[model samples]
Target: MDKKLIEELKLKLLEEKKDLEKILKGFAKKDPHTPGGWRANVPKYDGGHMEEESDEVEHYQNLLSQEASLENRLKEIEEALDKIQTGKYGICENCGKEIEIGRLKTYPAAKTCLRCK
Candidate 1:
């Protein structure tokens, strides 16, 4: 892989990591007990109004779903950044082959090459 390409991918991954963290912070709280972990904030309801309670619960559920998805993506990005540091980025984890440059450009965190995927 070209050094320039690797550098570009690193920049892309860093930018993506920043964006993911920003999005996660909007609807989730960082768990103090867990490293790089987050939890969706539960909606608070007042006066025990049944309808309002249900609405709040529904909103909480939606946020939880989004949080899980974002957390997984963030993890992958972190792993990719780590691999870069170890001089192992852009290799397909499943096949030990170089991942296509186009794929790396499209998804810097990809763990598999086109054939392995």
Candidate 2:
């Protein structure tokens, strides 16, 4: 990839990383015991109300799944930024071929080319 394009992708990845972190922070807490890990904050219901408690549990489950997905994407973006710093960005992880510029523009965190994907 061209230097200018790589710079643009780097900026995009950085912005995405910041945005994901902000969103995850809203309903999840970073796991200090485990680096790069986050746990959804399960809201506590008062008086042991069964219905409210069940709803809270369900909401927690949904947040957990969303947090996991966002965390994974953040990791991918971080890795892609690292690859760019190491002069290995835009390379397909599966076949070691150059990824399409258009695809990279759409997903700066992509690790695989369209063919590999």
**Backbone clashes under 3 angstroms, per model:** 0, 0
Give one digit per residue, the lDDT tens place, for model 2 in 40-78: 887877868788888888988898789889989988998
Q: What global local distance difference test value does model 1 have? A: 0.90
Q: List where candidate 1 sits over 4 angstroms from the true fold.
A: 32-36
Residue 10 miss distance in model 1 (angstroms): 0.7
Relative to the true structure, candidate 1 reaches a TM of 0.93
Clashing pairs in 2: none
Measured against the true structure, the TM-scores of the candidates, in listed sequence, are: 0.93, 0.93
lDDT of each: 0.90, 0.89
Model 2 earns a TM-score of 0.93
- For candidate 1, which ten residues in a row score worst on lDDT? 32-41
State the displacement of the C-alpha of residue 81, model 1, in Å, after optimal TM-score superposition. Answer: 0.2
Candidate topping lDDT: 1
